[model samples]
Target: MKLIVRHAPLFALFVACGDPPSDTGKVVAPDSPSVIVDTPKLAANWPGYYSDTLPCLDCPGLDTQLWIRSDSTFIRLQKRIGLDSIPEGIIGRWHVVNGLMTVGYTGDKPEFYRYTADGLLTVDEMGVADNSKQDWTIEKFADEIGDAIPRMRLIGTFTYWADSQSFQPCGAEFSWPCTGGMDLGEEEGEPIVRFNNADLQKAYKQAVKRSGDPWTVEAICTLGMGPAAEGDGADEYIFIEQLPRTIERCP
Candidate 1:
């Protein structure tokens, strides 16, 4: 079975809250008489970030993590109930229309969201609230708290290749292949970080000193890109340590 490795354990707590019903409003046509004209502007803290466990009919629950960045980028990590698989993460653009947040996903219809002071309410494809599913919400997290944790792209459990002196990052609930191994070279006496999460760095420092195998402690790290391959593409991941950024023991 695939393992479920998360960037930080703190976010696991987001699943405990109860999300209210989605009575915010209904989707309307551009020229409809019922169109919401006085849409509320997004709150300054509305670059919503949340992680929660949602009620599931097929399984025990669905573990999900969501991040809506200031730059209109969105990332969501989701895993099914009772399945021991890496949580798949998707990153793309997000926009707000008529007080509803729309998340763009690849080859899939955009997911609509309604924001409240408490958390984000899930809207179905028909642009209506889905009351059928319980806990259809992700509690908002503070920006500093969210920033303290590494972005979804850089979160995962990894393995070390002693023979080749390489580090292999494995997917926790997703099926991502790390064709290019990770690099640990320092820049200015610190680990080269594209996505800097201060807490994550401390974990790496702790991992490096562990007497046991490296895989026994999961560390936030970056994918290696050769100097000749600079600007080839964005770095796949970055490590940010949170309070509960416990390393996953190798299974």
Candidate 2:
């Protein structure tokens, strides 16, 4: 008993100071892993404004009109052409890093775009086309839009992550991935898109009216932007994923 007492304190001290002898290994608590989403750290550029700087004039499908206020804080958008049933006014939070912007909405996960000083803006959620939330009074444009809007063909769609594109015509199609840091095309003249067929127009019109398949429009637009080709309008790109319609040439 004396021997046991003499060593008990030493054993206790060893257990206290030495490596833990539990075979359970590191007890990683089974607590839920926290999700780390990037929240925008507001910058000094309070009340800054960012819209489509490289305006997509007439890309097939989708309709777009996004205006993000600087501080990457608030945004507002509407249909630049045609009308929609989905409510406009997608009020949300935003983050801007360098020229990139991440917009976090109240009802949905966050998205990305670009903020610029030169009035040139770009956004993610692009596949081929896409929407905005605001006070859209389609009833007002009812006279001119007509039932055609419900089934407009030329207005097919796509949802693309639009960036400043230095588009190069690969084999047959124009591949718009270049290293020019969001080139707003030629910022000299107006940009425009001329529909070459009826199906294209109809598919697009349907999207503008329905905001669904066959023309899930994810359109883009800009202000002082132009096309690589000669034109009298603004530059445009079809954000495809967000849209269902396509300009797939008929067989």
Candidate 3:
């Protein structure tokens, strides 16, 4: 017997029992009951501002500010205290697993954090708390931080399903509808011009071995609100600016 796994209009994956499907599609083993893959929801009090000054070997210290949004996305800002350089900002997806939170960035190893009575404490990759730590905890803020959305490079799998194109960012559970274009304006300002995404679409199509197959890709992207794929309300969408190449898998 075969099971028809449907991801809510995204795609209908046929899973064969006993024997794996000969097709090179990514499918869970027959023993697993869940067909839909989604990241675990964060705790109620997990969405907030977390900050700390970490010890730096070559500098005075590293001041870090992390904003955990309710949308599973995060903004991180870090600055060397004594350096003249400006603070570096990074945007990525955050998820919780096994009572620990992991922040994943494109092409970077994930960082883990464990919830504590006071706040969130830094932990190793194996979820072990630092032993000889000198204040590795990040204090939580009561208020939210106001920061602009920054364009970021994303590594994800692109799929053309149900006549719609979507991208699933690496380490992210949900896939967002993707639009190919370049916005030439400030984050809050109205975009004056829009660039076509013919090349990007062409690259994605060429990478797919079979129709409706998901292709791992790397691209520069921006997040914005748009019409939902199947609903009446709006949802967050990924705007692709540049498609570099199709990667073998998520790095």
Q: What's the lDDT for all of these models?
A: 0.51, 0.32, 0.72
TM-scores for the candidates: 0.45, 0.24, 0.54
Which runs of model 1 end up more than 4 angstroms from their true locations? 1-44, 125-127, 144-179, 183-251
State the weakest 10-residue window (summed lDDT) of model 1.
Answer: 7-16
The residue ranges of model 2 lying beyond 4 angstroms of the native Cα positions read 1-46, 50-72, 85-87, 97-99, 106-109, 123-251
Instruction: Report, for all candidates in order, the number of backbone clashes.
Output: 10, 64, 0
Best by lDDT: 3
Ten-residue region with minimum lDDT total, candidate 2 = 140-149
lDDT tens digits by residue: candidate 2, 1-251: 11211212121222335778564443343445454556564333324333331223463223543444443334344443444433133434565555455554434545554322233233554411124532121111111110101111222223222223232111112233212112324334632332222333444445444323222332222122334444565443321112223444211
Ranking by lDDT: 3, 1, 2
Candidate 2: Cα lDDT at 219:
24
Preferred candidate (TM-score higher): 1 or 3? 3
- The candidate maximizing TM-score is 3
RMSD per candidate (Å) reads 22.1, 21.6, 23.8
How good is model 1 by TM-score? Answer: 0.45
Q: Between prediction 1 and prediction 2, which has the larger TM-score?
A: 1
Cα displacement (Å) at residue 238, model 3: 1.3
